[model samples]
Target: MPFVADALTATYKGIPPSFQWPVKFCFYNSLIAFVLGAATGNVSQVDRVWTFLPTIYAAYYALLPLWPSKSPLPLYPFVPETAHPDVIRNYSPRALLMFGLIFVWMCRLTFNTWRRGLFNLKDEDYRWEILRGKMPPWLFQMFNLVFIAFMQNVILFVIAVPVQIAAMQQPTGLGTSDCVLAVLALLDVAMEFVADNQQYAFQTFKHTGKKDEWPGAHIAWTKTDLKRGFITRGLWAWSRHPNFFCEQTFWVLINFFPLVAPEYPGYAPPLPLGAGTSLESLFPIIPGLVICSLFFSSTKFTESITAAKYPEYKSYQQRVSMFVPFLTPVWGLYLTLLGKKAEVDMVVYGQDVALDEKKKA
Candidate 1:
């Protein structure tokens, strides 16, 4: 199918006819939700609500292929007569590839998240627990409805519009780069699956007492006889957060699809300065980059909390690299930088002493 049509169809699917209202309805409803979130200070709740928007949208698109009629309604003027756009229509093939990729990506992610116990009609993320506890009942409830539930949901849906837009511009044929991108995407999904499964298994094993009986003498334990926390084997050994690394890399690979399209020569640029040439060029990089940054920052913040709680975490930090594989290089760089800073400070102090001596003379 043509990418543009596929993206448009997927986007349209996100909003079902049953819920589709006039433009004013969307605007007013969203405004009210935002206002409620703001009044209650539940911004995180808004973010959580936004996560489900894509799944809801994809479900709508899947049903479109089953529709018998091709008639366009007043409300949905963009609905096309067929799954793929006709070649005579000058649709870009690159766009179609991007759309397909994103659809697959979204499907995999939504399914994974769902299986991980993330989808509850009335449930919120554990991170929100602290914030919710601080606010009054009425205020938190209002915030949850507005910011946590409504506005956040809309924003995530809107931000994802670019993938759909890019998909709509698919080029007529694939290229070497496109083939490479396909392989990368598959690897990304596979890597993520392995990481998630490994983590889940380790956690389950610990809970079930399987870890205690497992025939491995290398496993570390704390002075209190508790298992020293953190995954150190499998992909985790390659990178401290291999799952996060794969997740971000997957998005970067997905973004490469648009660049490989013949019509979108503007998308690809040569490295060592390989950066997007236009705002559209940056679309693929944003999601993974933003998420990874958040992951790292959160990890650091949590480490601080863990250090306070455990008293052994400082040694663990010394043993485990943050996001990258192995700690030697990072620690070496840290020492190098520290030495430079110390040298600079000593030089400045020495200069001050010399000036003082001259003034006394």
Candidate 2:
């Protein structure tokens, strides 16, 4: 415990010992995921538990008052670093609120994963399957170790670090910003829910021709929905991936919740300059920026596969924004002014894309 505290402050003075437990957990799980995924060649090991890890991290902070001294919970390892007596007796109301929101998020994602049958132990992400075919076994294993297993777990832990921020601060009453954040968070979840339902409906109807499924059935499906080979209706029509857009927005909103502690024990500077907690911090923006960059790169990779499979998807890509909602129309205009929007729109709207090519000849 003393070693952890020393190592945490070895480089910088104010790095919180609260990170000890989570840091250990990250190491253990990353090793397990890499080993299991490498042995099985099913690299979705992290995906199965992704929904719950943050909630676990969150529970540590939100319920810090309830935790036994020196650990998040009894029998669990934790930093022996001193905790604020005030926080120990009466916890942060804001952390509780943040935990509640993330709990809702975890539930929504878990249910969606269940409905998609991803909870099955053997299931892997479709993208991983593609990557396996493209890369050599040695290189892919390195990727699994570095990116899929370790880096992703670290990111997941970092994103939840904001909640840990909540624990270190002095307890306070809920403020107006909390109300605004709660409202916007709910709205963000709602839009993502609709986007998910629309995609589920399309996939279901495409296979079973069953429009009777509860949430997905809300939309009326037509021949066009079936013809395009990819969704271009509902929120999907608004942005190629409205759900992803909301996902990024939700975390950024979570990052903005009103707890400013540039001097807090847990605060870590994005760069190495200051010796103590006096360091100016960019901690809040790190989670949002990291995730947005991940989404951008992942979206590009995902679209590459989709574009190759469906000829019409290229037109959809040209017509729609990848993650921003209203910007789809703006991009469509860009295609239009280039004198190709009509043909592209026809393709995206489920008309014959080849007809324009034939006409050009």
The backbone clash count of each candidate, in order, is 21, 0
lDDT of 2: 0.77
Residue 129 in candidate 1 has what lDDT?
70
What lDDT tens digits, residue by residue, belong to model 2 across residues 58-103?
8877887675656455238554436556656777888888999999
Q: What would the per-residue lDDT of candidate 1 be over residues 1-361, giving only the tens digit for each residue?
A: 2673455445554442322322223334455556655565544434443434443343333233333334354233133443344322444445445456556666666665666666543554555575567789788777666655554555444334334334444445767877788878787777776777666556655556454323222333222222445454556545656677776676656555554555565333221122344654555455455555656766776666667765545544554466666563565467467665344322222344445547769
Question: Where in model 1 is the C-alpha error above 4 Å?
Answer: 1-93, 133-155, 158-162, 210-226, 265-289, 297-310, 326-361
**Candidate 1 lDDT:** 0.50
- Model 2 — which ten-residue stretch has the worst lDDT? 268-277
